[model samples]
Target: MRRLMSNNLILSLFSLKMFEIFGCIWRYIAFVSNQNTFLLLTILKNDFITKNFNYKISIKT
Candidate 1:
Protein backbone atom coordinates (compact mmCIF):
# COMPACT_ATOMS: atom_id res chain seq x y z
CA MET A 1 0.00 0.00 0.00
CA ARG A 2 2.84 2.44 0.77
CA ARG A 3 4.55 1.66 -2.49
CA LEU A 4 1.35 2.23 -4.43
CA MET A 5 0.80 5.59 -2.79
CA SER A 6 4.34 6.67 -3.55
CA ASN A 7 3.96 5.67 -7.19
CA ASN A 8 0.76 7.63 -7.48
CA LEU A 9 2.36 10.70 -5.92
CA ILE A 10 5.28 10.55 -8.32
CA LEU A 11 3.01 10.20 -11.30
CA SER A 12 1.00 13.23 -10.23
CA LEU A 13 4.12 15.32 -9.81
CA PHE A 14 5.42 14.28 -13.20
CA SER A 15 2.15 15.22 -14.85
CA LEU A 16 2.20 18.62 -13.19
CA LYS A 17 5.73 19.29 -14.42
CA MET A 18 4.81 18.31 -17.93
CA PHE A 19 1.84 20.68 -17.87
CA GLU A 20 4.09 23.54 -16.81
CA ILE A 21 6.49 22.84 -19.64
CA PHE A 22 3.66 22.76 -22.17
CA GLY A 23 2.34 26.08 -20.91
CA CYS A 24 5.73 27.71 -21.36
CA ILE A 25 6.05 26.38 -24.87
CA TRP A 26 2.58 27.61 -25.80
CA ARG A 27 3.34 31.12 -24.53
CA TYR A 28 6.55 31.27 -26.57
CA ILE A 29 4.73 30.24 -29.71
CA ALA A 30 2.08 32.90 -29.16
CA PHE A 31 4.73 35.57 -28.73
CA VAL A 32 6.54 34.61 -31.93
CA SER A 33 3.29 34.55 -33.89
CA ASN A 34 2.34 38.01 -32.66
CA GLN A 35 5.75 39.39 -33.58
CA ASN A 36 5.51 37.88 -37.05
CA THR A 37 2.07 39.39 -37.58
CA PHE A 38 3.28 42.82 -36.58
CA LEU A 39 6.22 42.60 -38.96
CA LEU A 40 3.99 41.54 -41.85
CA LEU A 41 1.63 44.45 -41.21
CA THR A 42 4.50 46.94 -41.22
CA ILE A 43 5.78 45.61 -44.52
CA LEU A 44 2.33 45.82 -46.10
CA LYS A 45 1.89 49.41 -44.95
CA ASN A 46 5.25 50.41 -46.41
CA ASP A 47 4.40 48.81 -49.74
CA PHE A 48 1.07 50.64 -49.89
CA ILE A 49 2.69 53.99 -49.12
CA THR A 50 5.37 53.46 -51.75
CA LYS A 51 2.78 52.56 -54.36
CA ASN A 52 0.77 55.68 -53.61
CA PHE A 53 3.82 57.84 -53.96
CA ASN A 54 4.61 56.32 -57.32
CA TYR A 55 1.06 56.84 -58.54
CA LYS A 56 1.07 60.48 -57.54
CA ILE A 57 4.33 61.10 -59.35
CA SER A 58 3.03 59.44 -62.49
CA ILE A 59 -0.09 61.61 -62.45
CA LYS A 60 1.96 64.77 -61.97
CA THR A 61 4.27 63.81 -64.83
Candidate 2:
Protein backbone atom coordinates (compact mmCIF):
# COMPACT_ATOMS: atom_id res chain seq x y z
CA MET A 1 0.00 0.00 0.00
CA ARG A 2 2.77 2.41 0.88
CA ARG A 3 4.68 1.64 -2.31
CA LEU A 4 1.53 2.01 -4.35
CA MET A 5 0.84 5.37 -2.78
CA SER A 6 4.38 6.51 -3.51
CA ASN A 7 4.03 5.40 -7.10
CA ASN A 8 0.78 7.31 -7.36
CA LEU A 9 2.50 10.40 -6.06
CA ILE A 10 5.23 10.07 -8.63
CA LEU A 11 2.73 9.53 -11.42
CA SER A 12 0.70 12.50 -10.28
CA LEU A 13 3.73 14.75 -10.21
CA PHE A 14 4.86 13.52 -13.62
CA SER A 15 1.43 14.08 -15.11
CA LEU A 16 1.19 17.50 -13.48
CA LYS A 17 4.50 18.50 -14.99
CA MET A 18 3.41 17.32 -18.40
CA PHE A 19 0.19 19.26 -18.15
CA GLU A 20 2.06 22.34 -16.98
CA ILE A 21 4.32 22.17 -19.97
CA PHE A 22 1.39 21.66 -22.30
CA GLY A 23 -0.43 24.43 -20.50
CA CYS A 24 2.42 26.78 -21.22
CA ILE A 25 2.55 25.77 -24.84
CA TRP A 26 -1.18 25.96 -25.45
CA ARG A 27 -2.07 28.78 -23.13
CA TYR A 28 -3.62 30.71 -25.98
CA ILE A 29 -5.93 27.83 -26.81
CA ALA A 30 -6.89 27.54 -23.18
CA PHE A 31 -7.67 31.24 -23.04
CA VAL A 32 -9.61 31.29 -26.27
CA SER A 33 -11.39 27.94 -26.41
CA ASN A 34 -11.60 26.02 -23.15
CA GLN A 35 -10.41 25.84 -19.55
CA ASN A 36 -9.53 22.17 -19.75
CA THR A 37 -5.87 22.64 -19.07
CA PHE A 38 -6.41 24.49 -15.84
CA LEU A 39 -9.10 22.05 -14.86
CA LEU A 40 -6.82 19.06 -15.38
CA LEU A 41 -4.05 20.86 -13.56
CA THR A 42 -6.25 21.48 -10.59
CA ILE A 43 -7.39 17.87 -10.55
CA LEU A 44 -3.82 16.69 -10.62
CA LYS A 45 -2.95 19.15 -7.89
CA ASN A 46 -5.72 17.76 -5.72
CA ASP A 47 -4.62 14.20 -6.41
CA PHE A 48 -1.07 15.01 -5.43
CA ILE A 49 -2.23 16.80 -2.32
CA THR A 50 -4.40 13.91 -1.22
CA LYS A 51 -1.70 11.37 -1.85
CA ASN A 52 0.84 13.40 0.05
CA PHE A 53 -1.64 13.91 2.86
CA ASN A 54 -2.28 10.19 3.09
CA TYR A 55 1.41 9.48 3.02
CA LYS A 56 1.90 11.83 5.95
CA ILE A 57 -1.03 10.36 7.84
CA SER A 58 0.36 6.84 7.42
CA ILE A 59 3.78 7.96 8.60
CA LYS A 60 2.27 9.51 11.71
CA THR A 61 0.33 6.40 12.57
Best by TM-score: 1
How close is every model to the real structure, measured as TM-score? 0.51, 0.45
Q: Once model 1 is optimally superposed onto the true structure by TM-score, how far is the C-alpha of residue 55 displaced, in angstroms? A: 64
Write model 1 residue lDDT over 1-61, tens digit each, in one string: 7886686667657756765665566566657788776566556655755765675466446
Q: List the pairs of residues colliding in candidate 1.
A: none
lDDT of 2 by residue, 1-61 (tens): 9997797778668867865775565565557666777677667666766776686577557
**Which regions of candidate 2 deviate over 4 angstroms?**
1-34
Candidate 2: RMSD over Cα atoms? 6.3
lDDT of each: 0.63, 0.68
Candidate 1, residue 27: lDDT: 62
